[model samples]
Target: MKELICISCPMGCHLQVEGESVENIVVSGNGCVRGIIYAKNEITAPKRMVCGTVKINGATQPVVSVKTKEPIPKEKIFDCLAELNNTTIEAPVSVGDVAIVNVCNTGVDVVVTKGLSKR
Candidate 1:
């Protein structure tokens, strides 16, 4: 059995999952159907949205904020960050622009969160 707090809603229902494997898992204490799905997926294959800053060249700011277009596999987060850390983009970037494509081969793009003009 495992205990988790539901993040699917603001209610934050405490959940308990019991099973030997993902297929046989049973979830309880969820107030909504969404919470049950969340718990199951979280336990079997957790994912997370990554947000961070990347260095910019000749930009007004030293770095620009960015985020993954979709949640990535939890384990690949650090690898994704490593790629971002080693990257540098030119100025005149706009919001929603792809900073990195198919990051970590997860088929997710890293996009700029804020526009940055040339210095």
Candidate 2:
């Protein structure tokens, strides 16, 4: 059995899950249907949105903001960050430009969140 707080909504439902595996898990204390799905996925394979800064060359700012185009496996966050931290992009980057493609083989792209003009 496991206890978790549902983040699917602002209600923050306290949930109780029980089962040997994700296939048989049961959830309770959910205020809505979304909570059940959230609990199930949270237990089986959790994902998270990643946001960070990467170095920018020939730009007014030393760094630019970036985020994954889609949620990535929770376990791969550190690897993703490490890759991002080691990356350097040229100036005049535009928002929505792909910073890294297929990051960590998760089939997700890291995109620029803030555009930077050339210095």
Candidate 3:
């Protein structure tokens, strides 16, 4: 059995999961149905949203905030960050502009979260 805290909502239900796979697991201590799904996904292919800042040339700010357009595989978080760390973009970037396409081959783009104007 594995103990986990459900992050599906603000409730943060403590969960106890048993079994090796989603097909045969038993989950307890979830406060809502979303917790069940969260547990299942968490035990299987966990994913997370990646966010950080990247260097920007000619921008009023030296860096721009960025995030994954979608949740990426948890295992790829560091790889994604590495790619973003090495990335430098031009200024005049707007919020929602793609900074890196298919980042880490996860089929998720890294988008600008904060707009930056040319200096």
Q: TM-score of each candidate?
A: 0.89, 0.87, 0.90
> Distance from true position, residue 75, model 1, in Å?
0.8
Query: How many backbone clashes can be found in candidate 2?
Result: 0
Residue pairs of candidate 2 with colliding backbone atoms: none
True-structure lDDT of candidate 3: 0.92
Write model 3 residue lDDT over 55-113, tens digit each, in one string.
99999888899999998999999999999999999999999999999999999999999
The lDDT for every candidate, in the order shown, is 0.92, 0.92, 0.92
Cα deviation of 86 in candidate 1 (Å)?
0.8
lDDT of 2 by residue, 2-119 (tens): 9999987789999998984668989988899988888888988998889999999999989999999998999999999999999999999999999999999999999999988999
Q: In model 3, which runs have C-alpha deviations exceeding 4 angstroms?
A: none
Clashing pairs in 1: none
Tell me the deviation in Å of residue 41 in model 1. Answer: 1.2
